[model samples]
Target: MARYELVKRSVALITLTNPPVNALSSAVRHAIAKSMEHALNDPKVSAVVICGENGRFCGGADIREFAGPLRGPPLVPLLDAIEAGEKPVVAAIEGVALGGGFELALVCHYRIAHFKARLGLPEVTLGILPAAGGTQRLPRLIGIPAALELITTGRHISAQEALKLGIVDQVTEQNACEVAVEFALRAVAKPLSSRRVSMLTTPCPPDLDALLEAVTMQVKKKARGVMAPLACIQAVRAAATMPYSKGIKRESELMATLFNSGQARALQYCFFAQRTAGKWTLPSGAQWNNSKPREIRSAAIIGLGTMGRGIVVSLARVGISVIAVESEKKLLETGKQMVIGMLERDAKRRGVSASLNLLKFTLSLQDLKDVDLVIEAVFEDMALKKRVFQELSKVCRPATLLCTNTSGLDVDALAGVTDRPHLVVGMHFFSPAHVMKLLEVVCGPRSSSETIATAMSLGKRMGKVSVAVGNCPGFVGNRMLKPYLDQATFLLEEGATPEQIDKALEDFGFAMGVFRMSDLAGLDVGWRVRKESGLTGPDVDPKNPPRRRQGRRYCPIPDMVCEQGRFGQKTGRGWYMYDKPGGTNAKPDPLIQNLLEMYRSRYGIQPRNISDQEIIERCLFALANEGFRILEDGIAARPEDIDVIYLFGYGFPRHGGGPMFYSSMVGLERVLERLEHYHQAHPDVPHLEPSPLLKKLVACGSPPVQKWREHIKTMHSHL
Candidate 1:
């Protein structure tokens, strides 16, 4: 819907009137066309100004429309008509002009942007190119190289950057609509031929082919199996080599190729899934909408290790005063210096002064007594955590919230040690908390809705994709990781090398394979967990079979690697050997191959060649199978939450959706059949067995991932 008015007596002002981010829906598109027609036909109209009703210009096309057949006037022809109109049209950009919105601005003869405005063609992020003459017009307005980079990456630019790139004619701090009207009025007396971007020749570089080829390699290397960036590259090439008419047709052809693709569907699903994950709902009917979160002005962090330092930085950067605690004076000083340096570097990159003044490092728990919230980021030992909680209960005020940054411990057990159990929740920030976007708010049985809301709200304030999950060992992301890691280790015992398995997964779109990720994460962490759980070391029964643990087939290869002091990158060795201690580059060591051969010989097991298909099916299917169990257990409210966790926390490829969605994409029937087949072949491996939820879903015709919650009975929900 658009509202049209005559401003300055001669200029027709057409404002898009959709709420929030004025997305171009069918109705809005129809209104835009009609408004432009009237403006062109009106005798009094010398020029026209287009802007959104709210501060936001437009986000993009209404992505909800992508689910159905397109209606109303097609965007390309409508945009072309606007460009061809004899009356000069000016775009007034304020908040954002993305995808179709950015394309809409391109057709206008002039663009005036507010200082805070952001602009980009972000269709490639949804696995499609900018199809509404964007590919053709942008290169003509700016050069081919700049257009190619913006289109392929979907990176947004500020108004200053837009002005520097020549995308906008003027940038002002005043009302963009008013400035645009004045700009249009002045442009009415000038020739329109030069202002029409489509009529301009694209400035192609001399080494166009080489530049395109280099960008192609870069995109392929960065995104792996992604298709949209490559398609975008082809469209940009068309713009550089062909006339506007041909280039526009080529852009449409490229968009058609990507529009209905599976990759596009997965990426689009991910877009919606992130939004759905935030709408957390508890069984008591306390949800995101109803629950009120307390404002956290100041917080305390117990311990100043890697996670603690990052958490301190995260809190401080968001203008929340942070008091970081350590056990000793020496440790406190070390953490203080490290945190300051990290914050300084981060602030430098963001073009802001470091918020170091807000940070306070201390060796006393008494320093945290007055803080609004206290996050325990000490070691993962349960006893150590309980002691810390008990001390906090004695020291802190009754109203202060208590949170744990535990990766995979029982929140209820920790909550039991505190006087304010209802205030205790788990804020599981992934490693390097200052950088990673995920923050799993683990809601214990005793956690109050306000506590959960506050944790979720604080995570959002720190620019995190926070999902509220039910309390369980390892919560949602790490709990499901057990079976996935198990399957990868089992593949090694079956004669598949680490590189082979990793390659199979990497080719499937993972940024890094399991073994490579393990190396980076430090293999000793899991080894310590295994040792404490009595799965390995002296606690294991000597009478128990070496390859068996707790009545299930287990791989002790990781323990063996740890026995050799191959902790991971820190020690320069893990599944693969690094060049030196603290080195990142991993290479397959002959010593590991020899170890594998000896282990196989001692066990009298035959090594068989494994296919990439088997590796992917076994690892990923096992991962999804655990997700099904998590859903049935009520650990995650919906498939979207699980997917979002994997996407943001575990580096799950965006184009593959998440494990739950990927399982649905693979067909539940196929997953169940494969899981059953694997279970039959290895009766000793219980994880290979299909979960009840998977079988139930398969029996019920395997509805889409969004509909999975309906089938799950929440009678035994933990949240």
Candidate 2:
């Protein structure tokens, strides 16, 4: 709810009283419109001032509304009312003023923003355009080019940047509400007609045709497979051609079209999925709401390899003081240089200053004595990690937090070597940590809530989306990834070639297919892990199947490749041929094709041409099946959590709404039927076995892709 008070100073204050982002729902919108009407009629109220009760102006339209029937007053009419007001209105923007919130500001005659304010018409990012006359009025106010950039990209602008772009009239340090009120009172005498943006024509570039073509090309390049960007372009085009009312009509039509798109649902799923990931819980009953993160004014990192260097950069970029530990003096110097070089490159790329408040490098453990937290990224061997943690527990303060950078090791064992077991946790950063946005935070059994909170906070500070997970071998992301990788390898062992499988997944919307991603990451990484686990090489059991290692499904194709010294791009050969060792350029390899044929013949397997559809269904459905199992076991708290992990960590196509969501879209019955078909075709492949939860849902007549979880909830109650 919102209200308007007519102060004696000739300023009417319109306050959005709703808490938690004041997401302009129907009631809020109605209140705002009524307040504007009241302000317009009062003769004494010469001007109006608008601000939110809480720090945020608004997040956007209530996403919750998208789930239900839409029955609300259109926001355009309110904008029209605001624009046609007898006196000037000043918007006092603080926190985030987004979507219709920002559109409301555009309707105002003047805007004043606090320094911390972030404003944007971010509807395009949510797979919708600003239907509240934003596309129409923004172009009229800022010209076509600027308006197109703002609406098309939906990028948030700071108060300083907003002023520079002429999006805001002024930025102030004083109370934004009070300042806006003063400005509103001062602007009463100014001509309101000239200040109204809707009255002005959108100024198009002289080369209008060329501009249109450029925008089309840019949208095609950047927003492939998305509907919102294209719709936004069409709306902007209407702005240039039609009158204001007609242009608004076109915008509304475009909004309706995008609102029904699967892409819109997927994009919104991504938004809420990210928020859901923050609401993590552990088996011990600790949750995000109850945890308190300890402040880390200073931090330290052990070792200075590529992973270590990136860790240093991540910490330093977030303005944390880091003491980098390296036993080798020469290597330590090299690590220091790499850290600085990376930071410099990052600063130059972002077009920002390179001066981090407290980014430091050191070669001594004594330097970690006073630091609040330490992340050990030494070689992944258990012996070395244990020794480091043991020495760290002794040298560092007892209260200091300790983290391990192991991707697949036992976090519990790592913490066992430390005196302060409660302070130990796993912070697994993907390679090139400074750039990659996903951080899998693993909580050891004994890890305190504070440790979990601190690690999650650190991930946030380093610009990573952290997913708190219980400590399993590979945690959530990598553990689930195993089944998908196994399926790809099994496909190779069967009649399919690497190129065929890769092509199938690529067509399905992964940026790269499984084989291509493996090659780029260096196939040796997985090979080394497998070898260490005794799944291949001298440790293999004599009675094991040639292609299959255990009674369960297994593929030795990757192990076979490793045996040939084909370590992917590093060796110029893997699933595909490369130009040279460590080269990026990969092409279809006739050698790999012949090798696959030979293996198939040797194994008495017929090499029938596999269709792309088979490849797509097998890989995706296998991953999706595992997702259902995860949900049943509560390994993932919700279906949305799985989506967040896949979107951020595994590059699952966002438009498809991650694997679990896509599965839901495909319908549980369909997924179950497909699994049955595959299982019958290959009875020996036990991993093809569908989760019982999936079967129960299908049996209950609940579609797999939709409303599967509702069935599970009802069944769980009986259990």
Candidate 3:
């Protein structure tokens, strides 16, 4: 509904009403146009001021509407109505005014924004251009160069920056509506002829052609396979050449093309799925809505290794004061330097500095005295971690929340050592915590609702998508990864070369192939862990069959590579040959080929040709099967949560909509059949057993992933 109120001195205030993110739907668009009509008809209304119901003006067009059929009023008509409004109009911008929302403000005669307001035409990020006159009108108001840059990149600028760029007319400290009303009143008697933006011509510079050519080249380079960037360029060119109405028509045509593209659907799904991922539910019946978070004013980090250093940077980035602890003086000094260097780089990037140090490095657990949260990020030894948590429990405040930064450990057992068992949880951060946007928040058996809520809240504050999962061996991400990684190893045993597997998955849109990624991450990392676990070491029986473990399949290829000192890029060789240690150039090596042939002969294994399609199906379906199991157990609340974790945590392509969404698109029945076929071929593999939930769903004419849980609920009722 449109919220309309009259301020003092005959000023009409029209605010856009929406919750969460103010996504402008067709209904809201119609209301805005109707409000303008009412104001135009009423002589009592001297001037009009437009704002939003919430702090945010809008996040653009209803992204939800972009997925399915178009069912709402076009925002363009409403924008045109505002431009043609008879009464003087001013736009009151607060929070974010983006995409069509910013285009609405562009139609107003004057714009007044709060200092904290952010404004942009950010449709480009979602693989679309601003269709509601943003490309055309912006160029007419600002110059072509500035408008092109803003429209193409879709980066939001601050109110202060927008004012300087002449995108907004004024920046104010008072309420945006009050300033807008004052501006409207002041502009009432002024000539409306020059204020008509549509009637104006875009200022063309002498270097316009060169600028356009450069922008086109850059967009083509960056976008690669996307269609929207090129279309955006064409719309901007139309704005430069055609009349306002014709340019708008060109914009609409391009928008229609993007609206119908599969990329658009995928991108929009990516947006909503990301928001949904943060709302977690557990098997224990504790949900995101039911949880309450305690505020953490200060925090502590134990260990200053690579992971710990990144964690320190992440905490400081979110304005949390951190007391980083290390056991030794030398390691503490090294960590302090690394943390300071990273923070300095961050400050340089953001163009901001702090007089107060947000991070402190010390060698004692005594430094964690006043902190509310303490993160243990030492070596992955259970005894050491238990000891650290026990000591921290005694030293830190009783209310302090203890977190273990373990990739794959028992959070419940770790909590057992702590005095405050309810306050301990797992904050499994992805590699390079400051950079990656996914945090797998693992809840222990005794972890309280407040602990889970606080960790989720902290993840959001650090710009991470937090997914809550039960305490399994590897929780969600890595647990599902086990099968996928196993498939890659199986491919090697089945005669598929490392390059062939990597290239196939890379073609499927992964940024890097499996072997290439392993090489980059250092093969020795996994080798040492496997050796420590007795998966491959001196403790193994000599009678154990080669390339097999526990009567199931296993691959010791990584172990072999480590044994030979070919420990990935650091050694200039692993799966592929590099130019030198730490060099970027990678090429096939005859030495590795010789090693493969020798190993195959020693094991009496035969090499056979494997197709790329076969490789992709096996690995991806294996992971998807595990995802179904995760869903059945209620470890993940929704299919989109699985997709979100993969997209943000792993580099699962956004356009593919994660592993589960991709499997759904491929048809569940088909995926189940593939899994069954693979299971028959390898009867010893227990994880390959088809999940009962998946079989039932397929038997029942497998519905969309969103409705699977409802079916599960109904089945349980029958039981």
The TM-score values for the models, in the order shown, are 0.99, 0.93, 0.92
Q: On residues 246-317, what C-alpha lDDT tens digit does candidate 2 reach at each position?
A: 999999999999997888888888888888788776655677888888888788889899889999888887
Candidate 2 lDDT trough over 10 residues, lowest sum: 710-719
Name the top TM-score candidate.
Answer: 1
- Taking all chains together, the TM-score of candidate 2 against the true structure is 0.93
Candidate 1 RMSD to the correct structure: 1.0
Q: Write down the lDDT of every candidate, Cα atoms only.
A: 0.93, 0.83, 0.83
lDDT of 1 by residue, 341-394 (tens): 999999999999999999988888988889999999999899999999999999
Clash-forming residue pairs, model 2: 664-705, 667-704, 667-705, 668-703, 668-704, 668-705, 669-704
Q: Rank the candidates by TM-score, best first.
A: 1, 2, 3
Best of the candidates, lDDT? 1
Off by over 4 Å in 2: 283-285, 350-367, 570-572, 579-582, 699-719
Task: Please say which candidate is ahead in lDDT: 1 or 2.
Answer: 1
Residue-level error in angstroms, candidate 2, position 479: 1.1
Ranking 1 against 3 by TM-score, winner: 1
